[model samples]
Each structure stands twice: as C-alpha cells, then as structure tokens.
Target: MAGSELTNIKSPRVKAARRLAKRAFRDRDRSFLAEGPQAVREALALEGVVAELFTTAEAELRHADILFAATHAGVPVFRVSGEVMSELAQTVTPQGLLAVCRFLHVPLEQAVTAGSRLVAVLAHVRDPGNAGTVLRSADAAGADSVVFTDASVDPYNGKCVRASAGSLFHLPVTVGTPAAQAVARLKESGLRVLAADGAGERTLDDVDLSGPTAWIFGNEAWGLPPELLRLADEVVKVPIYGRAESLNLATAAAVCLYASARSQRAGSESGPAPRLP
Candidate 1:
C-alpha cells in the first residue's frame, strides 16, 4: 500500500470475476459490486463483509487511503484499467475503484427485531428510488429494520444501492419468501402492523408508534394488496391539506416513520410510554 510504483491489474482472474459480475451470477455466486471509491471505502468499513478490492491508477492515487485500508484488512486487492473499472461498475462514471464482497443474507430471524423493534414493511413497492428512500428514512429514524416483500425491486440493485447512499450496508434488510412469513410472524409476536393507506380513515397521529410496530408502505400505483390490508391491525393515512392528490410512496413512508420517531422521542422525554394497542 505504501509503494510508490503503480500496480498493474490485467490478470485473467480479474477479467473473469468482472465478467461474472455483469450477470446476476456474481450475486448468485454470493457476491456483489461495491463500486466507486466512496462506495468501496464505505463497504470496506464492513471488514469481513468485503472480500476483495479492485482499483485503477486513478483510484490508487485519488483514493489511496481507501485502497490502503482494503489492503490492510487483507482483502484481495487488484489493479485494473479505467475501461475495466467501467465494465464492472453499474453506473456510467467509474470512480476508479470497485470491491467484490460476499453478500451477507439477513435471515428473517436476525432482522433487527429481536426485541423492542420498530420496523418498516415495504410491500410490492416497485420504484427502486422510492424503496431506497424508504431505507434512507428508516436509517435516519432509527427503525430496527426495512423489509420488502412480494416481488419488490431488489434493494441490492445498483439504483437502490446508490439511492440508499450506502445505508443499505447500515441496517438489517430481508428480501425473498421469508419476508412474507416474517410479516405474519411479526404480527403473532405482538408487533402491531400498520399499513399506510391514503384511503384509510385513521391518521398516523391516531396510532401510538412508541411500541413495537411495523409500518407497511405499499406500491405507488396499486397500493397494498387486499391480504396485507386484512393483516394490518390498522390502516393509517398521512394528513394532506393540498389538492396535490397524493404524496409519493417514499415521501409518505418518511412521514409515517418519522411521525413514529417523533412520537417515540416525545414519549421518552415525558413519563413512560403509554401502552400502545
């Protein structure tokens, strides 16, 4: 890492790995791309989660500290060309560095709700940007978990990953079949399921989010599925004064989640939180 000479990375192994990364094969192979010097640096902080690092001359010079940290962590570091870096990067601009890291699947059982859990359940949310924004808000509001179910966009998808601004690596997020089961299990485990519905009569203010609650935000066009609606202990709406018709799904989610955060914080300031139903 302290060497003055530039490292050349033109090995067949790097090529094959970059090729595999283009397909879902890398993901299927239990790895993902953490591109950009900033992203690579953020991901490297995860240590064991980040298995390897790739860089070009620009990254080595511009992001030397990042490269140094990855090398120091004993992660496999390879030097490649800017062209190859572009090939491996999901985005248009290559930040000169990328990382191949093992994907740590968050089991439904381990998803932040071990106890005193406040979670967000995003159901069939189609927009990766919306989904990612929900994650950013959840991170900011200190929610225990953010779960997506029913063919929602992959949170690990490049757009979602970037939209999360690296928060995807910050929290417990579960995707896949276990997600559906996770919802039912949370309900049975005394976690209140509150679905966000503009049509619903109950306002978010009416619900006490101070306790264990899973705030469910559905897709933009279709909204919550009938079954999920039936599963909710209650459906809450964010009060709208303007004639704007409706808020974006992610905005609504931030409103709902932060409302809960605000209520929880206020409750903490006062006496004990009232028993939430």
Candidate 2:
C-alpha cells in the first residue's frame, strides 16, 4: 500500500476519508483528518496519534521525509493520487498529504484537572476558525487546558483543525461540556472564572490574573448571555483605546491569556504569591 497509487476517488478507503468532512461521520467514527505536511508531521510525532497517512505519488517524492517518519512510527502509509488527495483534503490548495487521527479530546474532569493554572472555556463560540484560533492562542500562552462547551463549534472540524496549526495536538482539550458545569468545576478546583464580554463592569487591566483562572469566551455575534455571565465569578472587559469597533474573539483571547501568563510568570520568578483576580 505504500508505493501503490490509489487513483479511484470512489475507493472505499477514499470514501471513508471523505466522510470525515461530515460531523456525524467524525463523531460516529471518532476520527478526524489532519491534512498537510505540518499537521501530519505533528500527528506522527505523538505515539499512536496518527491512524494512517495518505500521500500522493508526487508528494511522496517531495515529502519523502514525512512518509518515512510515518512508516517508521509503524503507521500505515498509503500512496494516493493528486485527484484523490484533493478530494479528501478540505483546503483550496491541497497539500498532497493527510492523516486519520483518533479523537484528541479528553474528558471534562480530566481536562479541567490537567494542570489548573490557566484554562480557556469557550461557551458558545460558533465559528470553527475562531474556536481553533483561540485554542492555538491558549497553547501559545501556556494555558493548562481548553474546554469547549456543548454549543461551541466542533474543534475537530477540518477548518478548526487547520486553524489550530497543530496546537490541537499540543494541549489537553475537553469538548461538549456545558458552560455552567465548566465554570463550576473550575471554581471547585479554586480557579477564578472571569467571563470576557464587552459589557463587563470590570476592565481586564483592573483584574489580578496571576492566580489560577479560567477565561470564558462567548459567541461572536451575541456574546455571552447575561445568565452565562452571571455564572462567572466576575465579568471582565478588554479596554479599547482605539477607534476600532471591537477585537475579534481570537484576538481578545490572546490578549487576555497572555496577560495572565505574564502575571503568573512574573509571580513565580519573584517568589511572591500572585494577587487574586
């Protein structure tokens, strides 16, 4: 299977890969596709993360290193055609490589307790790109984990996975948790839950983010509901000094998470307890 080209788009394996484009199929199979060399390479780096690897003939020659790594990891490497790769990939420009990966999400309790310093809870974020960007930002900020509430976009969606830029595999993530339940669990674990919204009474700069915290982000259009905001310990807003209307959800998340990260780092180095937010 490594050297042979799978040209037929209707091949059973090809069809199965294509079915991953649907949420129902991904849920049923508990598998998702990681396309492109970067995503595939990251998947292969983890033990048993990649179920299989698909490479086009031309791509196999160009990206032989990736294929070799996959094979070395004992993953089944199959050669596919350009047309077949395009059919299986979701991007406008196919990367000629793809991987079937097992579900990466962890249980809510497990993720909540993964490390407890900083967590990002997305309550009702509907956009897959935004959700993925937030996850990537969380990873960059050294957050402990990311929890996606039931109303949030599927983090395993192709667009979301691509937007994560391989961060999806780098952190502990819990999906399908209810917003209220997520907040309660984080609080029970002694983390301060700060709801990020435009109508918040307290500004982000006014809050002490050095303590363990869970930052909750809401939907793009409507933002967090009043009821949801009330569930949090406090509602915090990112101050806007410029003429720009509002920062997008991902940008806001990056700013808030990094602020917390900086505070935590500074506190640890100085041997002083971080102020509670």
Candidate 3:
C-alpha cells in the first residue's frame, strides 16, 4: 500500500501482544506481557528493549500520547476490543493496556547490595503474587537488590509484575539457586544473614540491623530452608499479640527489610554504628 493508503488502513485488534501473554507463548517467543498504564509506562521507560505494544481500544481508552510514544519507539501498537482484552489478559480485571517486552537478564553477583548494603532473599517461595509483592517492598524499602532463590515462583509472572506496580523496572533482581558454598561466600563477605522465624526468640528490636545484612524469608508454608537458617548469624520474628496465625511471606519480607532500613537510618543520624566481630 502507498503511504496515503497506509494512513487510511485499519488499526488492528488483538495483536501479537495478546498472544504473548500465554505462558507457553511467552517462553516460545521470549517475551512477556506487561499490563496496566503503569506497567506499560515502565516497560517503555526501561533502558532495555520493548518488543511490541498492544493497546486495546478499551485499554487505550483513547490515550493519544501513549500511542505517539509507542509509534515513535518503533513498537507496534494494535487496538483490541474489551472482550479481546479480557481474553488475552492474565489479570481478572483487564486494565485495558498491555505490552510485550523482552526480559532483562539480572545477575546475582552484581545486584546483591544496595543502600546500607542490605539485601533480601526469597528462599523457596512458590507463589508468584507473594514473590512480586516482596520485590515491590524491597525496592520501596530502599534495598539495593533482591535474590529469588531455590524453586521460587517465576518473578516474570504477570501477576507478580503487576503487583510490583512499577518497582520491578527500577530495582536490581537476581534469580537462582546459588550453591550452598555461595551462600557461605556472602556470609564471609560480610552479609549478616538474619532469617525471620516465627519461633525466633530474638526480637527485631534487640538486633542491631545497621550492618550489611541479608534478611532471608522462608517459604510460606515452612519458612526458611534449614540450611540457610543454620548459616544465618541471627534470627528475629515479628512480635504479634493478636490472634493472627502468621505474617504472609511478602508482609514478613517488608517488615524485616524496612526494619533494617529503619535501623540504619537511625544509626547514620547518631554517627558511626559498631559492627559485630
């Protein structure tokens, strides 16, 4: 078609972005779906590559600027109906906008320590939502990085990505089961591995969390893996007097990571803090 004819050509509905939302297709195509205005915006803002953009009519809701950016970036944008958007969307509620993006390969060694040299590890967490929520909190709590270890749920899952809001784009993330030797390596390198336990006698308030610490949270059902716990230098549990059973994995992670951040901020204000030999 000529340029003039192409201008008049119909925009598409239900394009490649919709198809890539499926798990199999995401793997086969090496692309994942990012939904909502914020998710799409972050994917666009990433210094990495965005494969394509699919904005349903309902999802786009006639947002012209978004269309302009998508076109300018050379990302293909298609229009899908409300029904089609729901069909392709992973969420129960379709936010009306979605994008297909290539996953950035995050390295474990490089992303380990951030502010206060504090880190959070998700050991053997299986739920995608919980994993994502933890990542979001880690980023919000000023953590330098997060490591999802063992058989944790795929952090790339749509729900997880969505749960993070836009934090996933900005934070450094590492996923893998590093050898036990590697865990020991981090300990020797100066990470105070503080595992959160329900039975831990030490209160979070008792421990000086201002040093380079790696706050490890265990599985939702079982808590931390024994090997990791055994390697930890300290263990602290949330003090709960209410009749509640236990904190959710993500909730526990937020509490621990923020506590570390809180302690460090206090220490910095008071002057140099002492470290354990």
Which stretches of model 3 miss by more than 4 angstroms? Answer: 1-25, 113-116, 179-182, 268-277
Ranking 2 against 3 by TM-score, winner: 2
Summed backbone clashes in each candidate are: 1, 0, 7
Index of the highest-lDDT prediction: 2
* TM-scores for every predicted model: 0.87, 0.94, 0.83
Give the alpha-carbon lDDT of every model.
0.74, 0.89, 0.72
Alpha-carbon RMSD to native, per candidate: 4.0, 3.0, 5.0
Candidate 2: tens digits of C-alpha lDDT, residues 144-247: 89999999999999999999999999998998998888988999888999999998987777777778989999989888999998899999988888998788
Per residue, candidate 1 scores C-alpha lDDT tens digits across 127-153 of 888888899999998888877775687
User: How many Å off is the CA of 206 in candidate 1?
Assistant: 2.5
- Output candidate 1 Cα RMSD: 4.0
Full-model lDDT, candidate 1: 0.74
Off by over 4 Å in 1: 1-23, 112-114, 268-277
